[model samples]
Structures are given as structure tokens and as C-alpha cells.
Target chain A: MTPSSFVKLDGVAKRWNGQLGVEGISLDIPEGSFTALLGPSGCGKSTTLRLLAGLELPDEGTISIDGKDVTTSAASDRNLSMVFQSYALFPHLSVAENVVFGLKVRRVSKKERQVKLHRALEITGLLGYERRKPGELSGGQRQRVALARAIVAGQRLCLMDEPLSNLDAKLRNAVRKDIKKLQRDLGITVVYVTHDQTEAMSMADTVVLMKDGHIQQIGSPDDLYSRPNNTFVAEFVGAPPMALIDATAFASVFDNSATVGIRAENIQIVPSGQGRLRCVVTESEFLGAETLIGLDHAGASGLCVLKPGLAMVAEGSEIDIDFQDESLHVFDADGQRLTG
Target chain B: MSAHANLERRRQAIYGWLLLSPAAVLLTLFAFYPSIATLWSSLFSRGTRRRPSEFVGGENYTDLFADPTFWLVVKNNLLYAGVTIPVSIFIALSMALWANSKISARGFVRTAYFTPTVLPMIAAANLWLFFYTPGLGVLDQIGSVFGLPSVNWLGQPETALWAIIIVTIWKEAGFFMIFYLAALQTIPEDLKEAADIEGASRWTYTRRIVLPLLMPTTLFIAVNAIINSVKLIDHLFILTKGGPSDASKLILYYIWEMAFAFFDAPSAAAMTIMVIAVLGVVAAVQFFYLDRRTHYQ
Candidate 1:
């Protein structure tokens, strides 16, 4: 364990109704770093966040926050704050009252509560909405109110469970940037939970990819994208995931019992009979900046090539495509990456 | 084109009213017409064997106002309402919290709580009658084991109304609990977790978050309880018969006795009109005052 680790979990496990929620999970989150628990639904990303927030107690393990074992402690004693996906703002209270609820519960002085409330509202861009009820606010405004409430509580560790999932696309982007900026400015450690890879990759200092109650990989977004630990991480980290093909199909490139992985962007098209492999275009999607051509190679589906700048490739056209050797990822038969 | 659009709108309005006519006609016949008829009759004198009915404007109301029994029953009804509404609502909320919690045999507990609601008020009154009966009653039998003297629960003026109030509360609380339980279920679980993470104590969370969120449900249940208090006079017919000097007689019970037992329709009609006016005021207060404060999605 690193001496600088601010939060540590050792072999944390949780079971719900005799089924594993998560098991054998260990992590060391550094101080003031923004880490994201990124995975698909039901992959225990939210469960991990809940555990850190002390909402759910681990069935097996010790959870230490700043060198204090809080595995058996109540959530209220954890000295953390959470922003929910539903916002969870008190509907009856005005925006100012909602933001100051934690301070009031702790019996903080009225003056200090007001000062913190004002600062939180200012940070979240909700200063003018002090008198509006949560029901009176828009989705984005409500989300900001929830953020302001968490910030005003002044907890050093803030947990957010898919907080931006409720907003529309444009508003989500704006709020995402705002949350990132707020975290950096406050120097508070944040553990964000998200199923959206784009959200995790764009905002997090470290992305902890999980699947099926296990951690797949934990690293910077570029590390996972450039050198995935396994086939799952390779496919999960990118925009359009990397394609896995049989090693025999690329026998001339390498003679090994492995799965050949190549991203869509690394496959280049050339004149027929000139490149290493020949294929026929089955479908073409024109996405303005790039055209994705779906190719049929040796009965393998989803062998796609992303061509830059509106390349027009008609259906059933014969084409030669070659993999970028330097960019190719080789995974062994067990699906583990063969090299760093 | 404008004429065509106008014709289309007229046709749509006719269709709308056509669909609503059945319920509208039923409400007029059963609800509106009776209220109007009762008000119209309240201004007149009751017909007797030797004399025809006469149009004595405000005479029935004047007589009603002068009657001490009328005032006493109104006080009793108010006391009954004052006791039953808040106590029953509090018990219902507690019961809902229990039923919604992760307790053993939860389904059985919910069913047991709701069973009293499903039982007819008359049958429930009969069941309670055995419990309130002196000496040989279940309550007295239990008291005897504790070496306590037999107490006449429904005989005295002070205890008679209270006994009836207890029975009404027992019956009505379970029905209101179903509403509270449904509302509690609709509250997101994440809110509780969020409260926990915010370092709010359980009591604080319930007061600041849970209870405020439940205000709409409380209002809804309160309105139902008010209506039930007026309509639920069936137990009185079997339990106390408003007995020992009309001690437990509510407005509805007195109105029934005046109309059927005394055959004084004008007096009964006047009391009925008064009841309707009180209910109208309550509805207005609920709609204009409370509704504005409630948050609904």
C-alpha cells in the first residue's frame, strides 16, 4: 500500500440475496484524484461507489478512509457526500435550504452555513435560484442544486452515482465540464460512477473498468486505450470498440495461437490486390467527418474500416485492407493481452 | 377553412360532453339534486296529521339553532373529529412505516393491518361491542387477570364518546395506512442513501426529507379522513346508539334520528344543509390553501 493512499479497500465483497454484488475487489484511491468506476449496468460500479459512501456495508473486507476503518460505521458517520442520479433534492425546501440541510443537521453556525451555501451555489451557478423549489427547477438546474448541496456539506470525499445521466446530451456535456472544474478547484477527491465510457474517459484521472463483479483494468484512459490488459478492456475502452479476429486469419503477420485485435481506425484501405488482405464492402455509414465501411473478410462480421473525409465506397466493391502493424493488439487464446 | 376548423372544434366539444354525460347525469341525480332538495326543504315546516306543510322561511333553522342537543352533538362531532383525525393519521403513518420495513412476515403484517379496513363497520362494531362489554367482556376478563375492577367503558358520558372514537380510529387508521405505504414506496431509495452520505441523522432525514416529501400523501389522507369522519356513523347504530343522553351522537346520527325516528324532515334537512356547508368549507380550504402548498409531479 502506498503511504499517500487516501482511501483503501482490501478484498471488499458484498452479497445480496446470496448472489455476489462484488467480490475480491481491492483499490487504493490517491488523495485529490478523480477516479471513475466505469462499467456497464449491474457490473458493481454503483455498488462500489455505494460501499465507499458507506451506503452499503461490505460483507467481507476492511474499508479505510484516511486511515480510519469505516466498514462497520453508518453512512452518516463517513464524512462524505453523494449526488444521486435522481438529484434527490428535498422537494419541499427552497434551493438554499436544500443546500444547507447538512450543515443545519450538524448544528453548524447560521453565519457559516450561509457562507458555505453561498459559495456552493456560486460554484454550481445556482446563486440566483435560492428561493426556487426543486420541483420548480429544470433538470439541469435540479442537478446543479444537488451538486451545490453536496459541495456545501464540505466533505472532502464526494461520491456521485451517475449524476449527469438524467440531463440531455448538450446539458450533460456542460455539467460534466462544470463538475470536473469544480472538483479540481476544490481539490476534493471524487469517485464518480458511470456506465458511459465517454464520460469516464473525458473527466477521470483514472478509470477503473469493471465487469461481472470483477475489476478488468484500472489505469489512465489513454493507457487502457493504447495497451488494454485484455480483450474486454480493448473492446470497452474505445469509441467504436476494437475488433477481435482469429490469429490464423493473420498467419502471415504472426504465427502464434492468439486473437488478433485491431481498432477500426487502424485498418487502411488500398487498391485491390495491393494490400495484405482483400475484402468486399457490405455497408457504408457516412458520419460527416468519417465514413465507416463494414467489410466481409473470410466470413467474419464487424470487420470495419474508418476512412477519413467522406470516402465513398459503394456496396459490393472489392477492396484491399491492411492492419497497422504497430497499432495491432495481440491477445492470447485466454483473451489476455500478450504484450505490454 | 376557418369555418371548417370551427365546425371541427364544435364537433370535438360535443363528443367530449357526450362521453362525460353518463357520469354527469349520475352525479346530478344522486349528489347535486339531493343537496339542492335538502336546502329547499330546510326553509319549510314539517307537515303534520292535522296541518299541511307551510313555507316558514328560516324558522326550522332558528329552531335548530336554539336546540341545545344540536349544539351538544356539534361539539361532540368536533371532538370526535379532533381526536380521530390526528391520532388515526399518526397511527397510520407508524403502521405504514412498520409494514414497509424489512420485517419478518411482512406480507402477513400488511394483511393484518388492512383486515380491519376490509371488515364492514357494522361487523367491526359488533366485534368491538364484545370487547367493551362489562364484566364478561374480553377487556374485563383481561383486566380481572390483572386484579383490576370491571369498568363500564360505554356507559358513562365521558368514556362513551371516547370508546366510540377509539373504535373509529382503529377502523379508519388501517385504511389510511395503505395510502401512506404507497407513498413511502414511491420515495426513491437513493434519497435515503443520499441523506446518509450527507451525514444527516435518521431522525433528521425523516423530518427534513421523508416527511416533507410525504406532505402530499398526508394531505390526501387527511381529506379522506375528514370525509370518512362525516360518513362513518354506522358503528354508532350498533355500539352506543348515541346512548346515555346522546353523549356520542354525531351530526350524521342525529340527522338520521331526526328524519326517520322523529319524522321531522325539515329539521333533518336543515342539519343536512349545515353539514354540507361545513364540508364545502373544508373542500375549499383543502383546494385553495393546502393544494397550493403541496408538490405534485
Candidate 2:
């Protein structure tokens, strides 16, 4: 209901074949911001995107775009555009033709459609390849064609479902940067779906983390990464996931049924007696610029510590573990963060 | 160059031939040899077996070109292919879309539509003959009950070919539909959703996205439809038998009558050669059309 709000889902629910795909969910995507719905497969992230795209109607509640109720509106009338994961370019159409398909469908004049198609292709850096079919393009190039098709429509809202997942790592990185740059330049609101937390963290203005058909935490990427609300978010957001340790081992550090979370890079591996906990190194992985020491502690859950340079200790080598008191996140029996 | 190199090359050639021997033998016996024999036979006179005949190269072809009956049969074949291919394709596309939609009893409906495809074409031809009977037939009965004139469905020259075309379309549309259905199903759901969000109307999406993507399947069905129309001859036997005025006659029926009914073996062989040539041309056109469109996915 806010002025700058571009899309809103109110009590939206959807089910398929008697199974709950998405439960009552309410959220808003503001204008001119890139947001990502990040979740694992079948976690209802794609389902949420489908509902917002008007591809699937919510079983309960309403959906709105630009403050207009469009819950029952046909998908064709929704004034939105989407890029599919498959990069679903028409195989028989040239790149320019694919980009102009929406305009042609709307009966736009040929001259106008041509101008828009060229602009879209140029923006996507596909200017010289207008006459080529999608089959002739590489995976990354095909993805750009899909992007161009969506961009040429110039709809108020754009939805992308794992658009870069099909590209190789190198192309994915390049396309990811291109997507963020294009979003900033165009000021178009985008609701991107990706299972890659890194994609969400790097490209999204706001990240909506979902799990099992429910929204886990919706916040800026840094907020979700640094101050996750539950065990799920804490574990889901970071690469080389946050190390969870039994808080009871350090009874002085906690007052209740013990739990503590530390990100991989947060836990420091000091000399054997510099910290409160004593541990034995189990395994170590030498990543460039950092070494992840997998350790075993007495009366505590296993921990993976990111230390500078090569292995500070060999397997079965006794090592001291330490984390700043303020950096250690303490949680209760139910995995909710507990305050001091 | 060297003895071992030569030996290895010979071994590869032997293995290659061994791998291809079955297909090569079958093609020579069934396709290549028969076609050559038919072409050779077409160059000879159609005299009785007791009298030795002399070669008359291209005479059969000249005679076929000159004959009004042969031209009429060719025209009939073209009419059959032209009408049946387009009409059946249209019906198949429509039926595929309808059956694929969120219709209640979709499986049952699909089964019902496809049931005719499995029935023997000869048996189906006989069944349609009963329906086309004048006055007391099912079609006539239905027409008379509505106070419409009960016209002879297949007896008349003007209506016989049309009646055959209708039955052929009805019989084959479902078979063609299964191909279209498979093509339709292969189109990613994401593409359809993308079109919908682009504000493309249903017709626009189908025309621009669905149809073009299914081009391969369309060409496939078209080639098969033409082949089936030209080669198959069940309807002629039950309904018109080359018609009141040879109206419902197809090339195959004419060939049958030429060889067996008229006992003109060389003429029949010549006509058969022509038919094969026509089929080859049609097949070649399809091959090129398909070659250009194949996505190599």
C-alpha cells in the first residue's frame, strides 16, 4: 500500500495436487530494486515467481501490481515480462524477431518494434547477431537473447527464474555482473529467483530467503548473512556454511541449553592455549589465500575454521580455537538467537 | 604406405562393410532391385506373354501423358493429398490443443479421438460405406429427421471424392494429432509463461511461439500425410471402386486396375515406376525442409 511499492502479495497461497506448494505469504517488492527469491529446489521460490508473474493464480488471497489488483487478471493482461531459466527463445525466430515478438503481438508498428528490438539487443550487447537463430548461439548468448526479449517489452516489472544458472561459471559471473549493471541503469524492478546464495548476495538489492513454502527471512543480503534469524538462515546464507558448536562446552559463555553459530571466516585458529576451547584438527582444505581447518572439540559440535595461509596444524594436531565474544551467536534450545 | 598400414586400412573397410551388410542387402533387394526392375519393365511392350515383345523406350511414359484417364487419376491423387494433408493437419492441431487443455476427462477424450487410428483402414472404409448409404443410412436418417434432403453420399461423382476425403481426414487426424501433441508437450512451460507475461494473446503466442517451434513436426506430418494419401487404397475398394465417373480414383487404384483388371503388366509396371518417382520427389522435398529446420537439440 506504499506509494513506491510496485508489487504486493497478500495472504497468497497455492497448492498442487493436494500438497501445499506455498502457504499464506505476504510481501512487497518496491519500485526500481532488484530482489531475489533464494531457496533450494522445490522450496517454492519458483512457485512464488510463477504466482507473481500471473502464470499461476494463488489459491488464496490477492496479488497486485502497481497498486492494481491483478489476482484474477489473465496472465496476458498483467503487464509484466519474464526471462525463463531455459532461455526459451523461439527456435525459428531470429534474435531480433524474438526480441520484437511481444511488440508484434501487441500490434505495435513495425518501425517502433524495430527500434525497440535494436535498443534491447544493443543494451544486451547483441547488436550484430540480430539475424541469427537461438540454436546457433552459445548458452550464454542464448541467455542474453532471452534477456533482450524481456527487456524489449519494457514491462513495469520483470521476473527472472534462474536466468544465469544455465551458463558456465565464467559466463555466469560475466552475465551476473551484466544483469546487476543493467538493472541499475534501467531502474526496472526485478524479482529474480536463484538457488545460489552468492548470486543473491552479490546481485540482489534485497534477499528473500525461503524454505519449505515459507519465507525464512527477508532483508538486505548483509543482514541475512550477518544476523540470520534462525538456524536455517544462518546455515543457508554463507559459503562454507556457518559452523555450529555446542554452547554447553563453554558453560561460562552461555546460561541455557547451549548453541552458538560462527561463520567460517569468523572463527580464528590461535595457538593451542590462547582461547577457551581446545581442539584437534581433523582435516584441512588449502583454498587460495585461506585454509579451512576442520576441527573436533571436546563436548562440542565439529567446526570449520578459516585461517590465513596454509594449514596451521596437521591432522590430529592439537589446536586452540577462539572467537570474539561479541561475534559468537548464542541460540536457545529451539535455535532462536538468545540475547545476553 | 607400409604393409601394416595397408592391412589396417583393409581391416577397417571390411569392418565397415560388415556393419552395413544387412541394410545394404535389404535396400538392394526391396528398394533398389524392385525399382530397377519396374523401370526396365516400363520400357517393354505390354504384349501377351506368348509373344516375344520388343523394347519401346519412353513409350509408356508418352502414353501415360497422353491418356485422359491417367491425368484424371493424377489429378485425383493431388486432390486427395492436398485436401487430406491440410484438413487433417488442421483437425489434428485443433484436437491436440483441445485434448492438451485443462479439459475434464482429458485421457478419455484422447482415447476416444485416437481409437479410429488403430482400426484397420479397410475395415474403417467398409464402416464409412454403411454410413454413406442413401436414404436409410445413418447420415441420411439424421438428415431426414431434420427435414433436410437425403442426398446420395457416395454414389454421385461430384460428392464421391468429397465423401472419401471427409472419411480419410476423420480417420487420420488423430494419428497426426499424437505427433503434434508430443511436439506441443516438449515446448517448455516457461516459454508459455514468458509469452503470457509479455501480454501476448493466446493466438499470438500459439502463432509466433508454438507453431514455429513445431515446424519440424508439421513437416513430418505433411510428408507422411502425402505418402499415405498417395499409396493407401482402402477407400476405393469399399466406397466407389474408381467411381461413377472415375471420380474417387487414386493413382494406386488405377495401377491396380491397370495390371490386374486390364492385364496390362508393362503398363502397370510403368505406372508403378511413375508413382515411385513421384514419391521420391515428395520425400526429397520433405528431407530438405526437415534438413533446414532441424535444431539438432
Candidate 3:
């Protein structure tokens, strides 16, 4: 493990009855950085978070947090807190009671508990909700309570497992900013797990995309979006996803086995018989500010072009789309990114 | 429009009454009428062939107050309620927690814990009857193997109520456990995980989270256990018939004796009225007080 990494996992592997839960996992998280484990459901993003939280022990390799080996440490012994997807606020407990639960468990003095609880509640904007039971609070308020509880202990490391998944869309957006601000203000290292690309891209300093029990790519959001390491990352990390085109279509430039990838924003919808490749408009989705025009081609999947304004293109209309040769991401037959 | 609104209101009123009619009819026929009839009968004197039944207000109530046997049965039931309600609830809670854990043979364990509930109470009493049958019983057989004396369980005043209490607890704990198990499952596993991360010990989690979450279930089980202490006297008939000296005589058993064995219907009716009043107050207290404090999801 690197000395500079605040939390490090060295070749960590976990399994369920000899089946692959997660394998050959290695990561180094710096202090006070937001790292999101992003993937589809059942992609072991949750397994990775649980392993880091010390909730699940890996079958092989070591996990270290804050430069200490916590491979087999109990969750509490690791001195880290967690925010569950369900919020997990004790239903019978008031908001103040839930926030101070960890402090009380750690036997912190009454005065200190009160001080910390007050500060945590204030930071989460839940000052007036202290006396409310979780059941009595709105979904957004309950989420803040979970956040307050996670931070009340002043643990330097916080693990959040899709904490905003339970909230509605508008509340999710607000809480997203709140959580990002909270992490920034506290300077706490966070390991967040999410299946939502928007959440990961918008908040995380580093986004680790995984597929089928293995890390596909680990980099900044821009790195995953602009330069995906594999075909899966290309398709999984964007809003509309990157389009995949068979290299055979670009007969002169690419190897027959290679696949070419391009973003919708980079592809321009030129007039028919003028652009490089011909495509038929499959569907058009008007997203207020911009309309996304989905295109269908013989050798491509997820071909789309972003048109500004309500560009209602008719379905089955032939259109020619073009992208600069430099913008094309070339992946070999094995689906691994090929360096220029 | 106002007429249409009135018509709609009338339709809604009719729908509401239609929905409530079944319950109202059942209660009036079986519960309300019987309670009022019992009260009316309690105010009258039992009739012989020579003298017809006559009004004797407060006489049967006073006679019950003067009866030593009634006091003894009341005391016996009080002790029974105190022991069986708490003990059975405690056992049920423990059994529920154990069975809900991730253990091997979990299905078998749950089935074993639930077996007593599946058996009829009389059949269960019969099964315990074999265990309390002096020299030929299971308890005595085990005692003898340990070189201990085989004492008569059902025939003695001191041990008869205790033996019945044990039987009631054994038969009841399993039934209460099913409710506890259902309540336990409703408490999400996430709470335990959250507690684990909070540095709370397992016992602390149980006390702070699990136990409080189970308050509604505990209150329900307590009410059922109290009612069963009085109502489930079927075992008394099969085991001791309210015992050698009325030692195991619960209030319901004594009431049955007053009505059928002694043919004193008025006194039995008075006792039943008292039972109903006490139960009503208790149910009201539990509903009003504990319901507000409980967190139901």
C-alpha cells in the first residue's frame, strides 16, 4: 500500500460459496476525497463499499484505512461511519437520539454529545427536527438525519451506500449538493456507491466504474467520460451512452476487429448524402434544453446526436452523421482501449 | 349542483353504513346482547321450582364479596397472570430472536418452537398431564433417574397451580413467539447493520432498537396472555378440576363451577360482569396510553 493513500485495498477478493462476488480489487483513496463506486445493480459496487466499511471480510488480500490494516476489523473498530440506502434511522428514536446514537455508544460525555449533536444537526439544516421521529419526518429530512448521524461521531471516514436512492428527484438534487458541501466542509474521506451516473459524475472527485465483479476504470469523471478504458465503460458512464461502431464500417482507418466509439455531442447531424456515415433516425427525445436524436446504423449501436432546441426529427428519415477521426475511441476485439 | 352534491353525500353515507353493518350486527348479536343480558341476570336471584326467579339487586354481588372461595380464585388468577404473562412473553421474545438469526437448521428450529402452538390446548394439556402424572410421568421419571423423590404434582395444593402455570407457559410461549417472529422480521436488517457500525453492542442494539421496535408486539402479546390466563381454563378441568383445594382455580374456572357445578347462575353472571369491566378498562388503558408511544411502520 502507498503511504500517501488514506485508505487502500491490496488485491482484495471476496466470494460467496466459491462464486465471484468481487475479485482482484485494488484501490488507493486519498484523504478527504470523494470517490464514487459506480456501476449497474449487482456489479459489486455495494460489495466493495461493504468491504471498505469492514462489514464484509474479503476472502483474500488486505484492506487498510487511515494507514492501518483493517482487513479483519469490526465496523466500529475501523472508526468509520456509514449511511445506508434505507437511511436506517431507528424508527422509534427522535432525530436527536438517532444522531447521538454513535456518540452515546462510544460513551462520549453528555456535554460533548449535546454539542456535537447540535453542530451536526445545524450543518445538515435539521435543527428543528431533533424532536421528530424518523416516521414523522419527510423523506428529505430523514436523509439529512442519516447524514447527521453519520457525521455526529466526527469519524474522518464516511461510507455512503446510495444514500439518495430513497429520495425523490428534486430532493435528490438538493441533497446531492448538500452532501458534496458537507464532505468538503468536514474534509472527510468518502467512499460512495451509486448506480446513477449523474450522481457519480456530478459529485465525486473520482469515479470508479465497475462491471461484473471487477473495476473497469478508476479516474476523474471527465476521464471516464472522455477516455473510457474499455467498451463497457464507454457505454456505461454517459447519460445517453457512447455509440459503438464496427471497425469494418470505417474500412480504411481501423482494423477489422476493432470497434469505434464516439460521444453524441461529438457527432454532427449533417444533411443526407453529405456526411461520412448514413443512419436512419430511430427516435427523438426532447430534453427541454436539447433534443437527443437517436440514430440507427448497420454496424453501430446507441448512435445519437445532440441537437440544440426542440429538433423534432421524424423517425425513419435517413441522415448522415460525421465525427472527427481524432474523436473516435478505438477499442480492439477484446474490448480494451487501444492507445494511439 | 347542490342537489347532486347532497345525493353524492347520501350515497357515501349509505356506503359507509353498508361497510360497517356486518361488524355492528355481529357485535350486537353475540357480544353486546350477551353482556347486557349477563348484567340483567346478575341483578336477579336464581329460582327453584317452588319460587320463580325474582329481582335481588346487589345480593349476588355482595354474596360474591363474602365468598372466601371467590377471593382464593381471584388471588390464584392474579398470581397466574403475573407469572404466565411476563414469563411467556419473555420466552417468546427470546425464542423469536434466536429463530430469526442466521443459524443452521433454522427451519427446523422455528418449526420446533411453533409445535406447541399447532397442537390444541387440551391436547397439549393432555401431553403435560402425562408429564405431571406422579410416578409414571416424565418429570418423575427424570427425578427418579437422578435419585430424587417423585412428588405428586397435580394432587398437591402447593404444586398444582405451579404445574398449571408451567403448562400454560409452555403452550402459550410458542403461539406468542409467532407474532414476535413476524414483528422481528419487520425490523429491517439495515437497523442492525447501522447499530453495528455505531459501535453499539448486540445487547445494546436489542435493548435500544429491537426491543423498542417490538413494543407494539409486546403489548399485544401481553393482552392476549392476560385474556388466556382467565379464558384458557380447559386444562384445569383435565388436570386438576381447579385442584385438591382450589389451588389452581382461575377466575373462569370458579365462574364455571358457580354456574354449572353449583347451579348458581346469578353469582356466575356477576363474576362475568366484573371480568368484562376489568378487561374493558385494561384494553382502554393499553389502547390509549401505549398506542401513542409505539412506533408502527
Candidate 4:
């Protein structure tokens, strides 16, 4: 592997009692980059992270970190740290003690441990709370403690499993920025596992979208959103996900039997008899700055168009929606993206 | 105050008392009344057929202090508590750790470890009685196979107390293990995974994380174990019965012997009062002192 590939997994597969965990899982993460394993629950995102952390062994293939084979090694031997979703702070230990526990175990000098602990806590904005136990801290403060603990060891690689999931929405947004900034400033390679697409897209430099224990696509957030590999990725990557139209509905446009995919923003409300397709306004949702007008068509599902503020249309009103031919995405019968 | 407010306040007072009455009545009937009655009777001489009973303040207690058998039982009990409390707790913790790990037949292992706890103390004592019964006993039977002498476990003075201690530990450890197991399950699995990623070894994880987290349970089990050291002497009745020289006697067994076997009710009442006082003090210390140091999740 090249030096850019700081961590690599090749043909990693894990099965429990003949049940699939993850199969043919291969990935390469560059140094000092943020890669997110994004998927819904039971899609093996966490399982892949666990396998890379050395918390679980793979049934096949190899994992190497910093050019060293570490597939069979213990989690500790692999030289990494992780933040759990529960924030897994040692409940009895004070913030400082929890952060420095691994250092003490590693026989680091007390002075060095104190230095590292102070730096980590300061970075995580938890400086004054070092003396407080986890039980005494707020949920957000406890989560910061978990972050401090993960960073205190100064490992080159850090893994985070839905670390912000337990926090409230406002706090999640703030911590999300803080984590991305932490990864950037520290120059650490971070592998984050999250079910929230917004978290993956907003924070990660590379998003590896997965489904049903297999990778759907591995690309930059823009790539996944703009050029999805399959129907699952096309629908999963964007908000108000991409809508699909059966080929028969648009048989006059394309001769091959394929599905048409289009983004919500590309579809517009056109005057009667002038639009490509006629649709009815089913419902309209008033967002703070915009309104999402839901459209119903016999040939389409999840067809909606974004309109400017306060665009309330009465339900059951017929509206014609039109889109450019070039903007449509074509997929084969198996849902694989078809190149023109 | 307004008449309506006053009426509401009176109703709340009555409601509060109604909530407390069940516990108040139970404690008075079972604990408080019995303790006061024991103290009252302890100050009097035991009544005889020819003589009426008369109050002899603190005389029964003085007689107990003068008795050699009382001191012997106290010493035996101290030794028993000192040895069995730590031994049983350690065994229970070890067994709990082993059984909690990811192993094949985990359900069977847990059930096997918990079987002795499910059996009643008297029934378990009888089951061990067969093991301690001199020649045909399991201990001697195993010893004979190793070409060792078939020594009497419960008949002799030195071995008799130890024999009782062994049965107590065996019976008590399994019961304590169940508590440890329950406490272990409350600990999140991700904590261990977090520890492992931090490079903590199995021993370090146990000592630093597992042991500290289990402090509350340990404190609770310790109080239970101390109370049990005084309370559970049923095995002594079956296995050693205060023995050839009162070598295997515990304080409770001596109290039972004083009241029922020898029919000296005053002495038994005095001893009973002392036992309650010691246990009450221990419970107080556990709540006021040790509870502060223990961590609850």
C-alpha cells in the first residue's frame, strides 16, 4: 500500500453463526483525513468500525495500520482510541482521571500525562470540569469528557461511533463542528460511524455509504449526492431523496427500459399543457426559509419541489411539473446507474 | 391561614402518616418491640419453679462476661467472620468474573454457580454433612485415594470449626455471586471496548474500571456478609453443634444454646441485645461512612 493509505482493509468479512455481519469489506483511508462509515442501523457500519478497531476479528482478509499488519492484534496493540455513543466514561472517575487512565496504564510519566490531559480537556472545552465525576456532569459535558479521553492518548488514529447521537439537536450541531475542527487541527486520521447522513456529509472528507453489510458507494459527499452509483445511494444521499420515475411513464423520451431519477430542485411548476408531466399538489410543508410542495403523480414516488417562502397551495390542486431532459438520471432494471 | 388551607394541610398530614403506618407497624412488631423486651428481660434473673423472678440489674450481662464459653464463642465468631467474610466475597467475585465472560454454556455455568444459593441453608447443611462425616465422607474418601489418613473433619476440636467455616463459605459465596453478576450486567459493554481501544490489558481493565464501578455492590455485599456472619449459623447446628469443646460455636449458636438448650433465658436475652447493638452499629457505619466512598451509576 502507498503511504497515503494510512489504514487499509482488504477483503474483510465477518460472519456470526452463518449470519452475515459484513462481507468483502475493503477500504483505504489516507493519513489525516476524516472518513465516515454512513448507513442506517443494521447496515454493518458499526460492525466495520469494530473490526477496524480490533474489537472483533474478521473471518477473512487483512487489516493494516500505518503499514503494519494489525488484523489479529489486540485493540490496544493497534494504537488507536474510540469514543462510544454512550460516552462510556468511567462513572466513578473524575474527568482528569478518565482522560489519563490509558496513559497511566501505558506507564507514561505523571508529568507528561498531566500535560496531555490538560491539552485534551482544553481542546474539548472541559478545562474547569476536570475534578468532577461523570455522574455529576451534564450529558453534553460527559460527552466532552469522552472526547477528551479519546484524544488524550495522542494516537494517530481515532474512531468515533455515533458520538454525537445522544446529544440534543442544538448541542449535536455545535459538537459536530467541534469534532470536525478537532480532527483538522490535530491532523489525526479519524474513522467515524454514523447513521445520520447530515453528520456524515457535514463532517467527513470522504463518505463511505453502505447498505445491508455491503458498500453502496465510497466517494466525496458531493460525489455521492451528485453522482450516486445505484438507486439506493441516489435515494439515500440527499434530503427529500431523489425521486424515481418508471421508464414506461416516459417511454417517449428513452427507448431502453430504465428508471428516471431527478432532484427536487430541478423540477418546476409549469403552466398547464406546457409541462412534461402533470401532477397534483398533495401537501405543502412550510420550512423556516422555504416551503416543500409535495407532488403526486401516478408514475413517480417521493416527487416534491422546493418553492420559496410561504408558497402554500391548496391540497388536490392539479399542477404541471417539468424538468430538463439532461438533468434526469437513468438506471437499469437492477437499479444500477446507467452511463449515457 | 384560611379554613380551606388549614383543612388541606391537615389532610396532607394524615396522608403522610397513612403512607408511613405500614413500615412503622412492621418495625414495631418485629424489631423495636422485640429488642426492648429482650433488654427488659435481660436485666432480670431467670424464673424458677420454686422462686419467683426478680429484677437483678445487669447481673445477666456480668454473668455472660464471666463465662469462659461465652468468650470462646466470641473468639470463634471473630475468627469465623475474619476468615469467611473475605474468603467468601473473594470467591464470589472470582466466580462472577469467570461466569460473566463470553464462554460456551454460559447459562449452564451461571445456573451451576447459583445452585447452592437456591438450596435452603438447612438443606445445604445436610448435603455437606455427608461430605464431612468421617470415614465414609467425601473428604476422607478423596483423601484415602491419595493414600492419606481418613481424618475426622467435624469430630475434632481444631478441624471442627474449620469444617463449619468451609460450609459457610461454600453456601454464602454462591449467593453473593448472584449479586456480583447482577452488578456486572449493569456495566455497559462499550466501556470494555473503550478500555480495550485505549490499550488497557485485561487485568488493568478489571482493577481500574470494573472494580471501581463495582464499589457500590461490594459495599452492599460487605454489609450483607457481615450480617450473615452473625446471622447464618444453621450449618453449625447440623455440622458441628458447638462441638466437643465448644470449638465450632458462634455467638448466635451460643445464644440459641443459652435460651433453648440450657434454658437460661436471661443470659440469652443479654447476648441477643449485644448482637443487635453490634449489627446496628455496623449498618450505621455502612450507610454513613462507606456509602459516601462508593459510586453508584
Clashes of 4: 0
Best by TM-score: 3
How much does candidate 3 score in TM-score?
0.97
Model 3 residue A92 lDDT score: 93
TM-score for each predicted model, relative to the true structure: 0.96, 0.93, 0.97, 0.97
Q: What DockQ does predicted model 4 obtain? A: 0.84
CAPRI quality of model 3: high
- Predictions in order: lDDT: 0.89, 0.86, 0.93, 0.91
Candidate 1: residue pairs that collide: none
Tell me the tens digit of each residue's lDDT in model 3 across A69-113: 999999989999999999998989999999999899889999999
Give the lowest summed-lDDT range of ten residues in model 1 chain B. B193-202
Clashing pairs in 2: none
Q: For model 4, how does the per-residue alpha-carbon lDDT over B1-297 read when each residue is reduced to its tens digit?
A: 699999999999999999999999999999899999999999999999988789999999999999999999999999999999999999999999999999899999889988988999899989988898888999889999999998888999989989888888998898999999999999999889888888888999999899988889899899989999999988887788889699999999999999999999999999999999889998999999989988887
Query: In what order do the candidates fall by TM-score, top score first?
Result: 3, 4, 1, 2
Put down candidate 1 lDDT per residue, B1-297, tens digits, no spaces: 999999999999999999999999999999999999999999889998899898999999999999999999999999999999999999999999889989999999999999999999999999999999999889999999999999889988879999999999999999999999999998888777777777777788888887878889999999988988888999999989998698999999999999999999999999999999999999999989999987775
Model 3 spans with C-alpha error above 4 angstroms: A1-3, A255-257
Candidate achieving the largest lDDT? 3
What's the TM-score of chain A alone for every prediction?
Answer: 0.96, 0.96, 0.98, 0.98
TM-score of chain B of each: 0.97, 0.94, 0.98, 0.96
lDDT of 1 at B135: 92
- Docking tier of model 4: it is high
Q: Give me the chain B TM-score of candidate 2.
A: 0.94
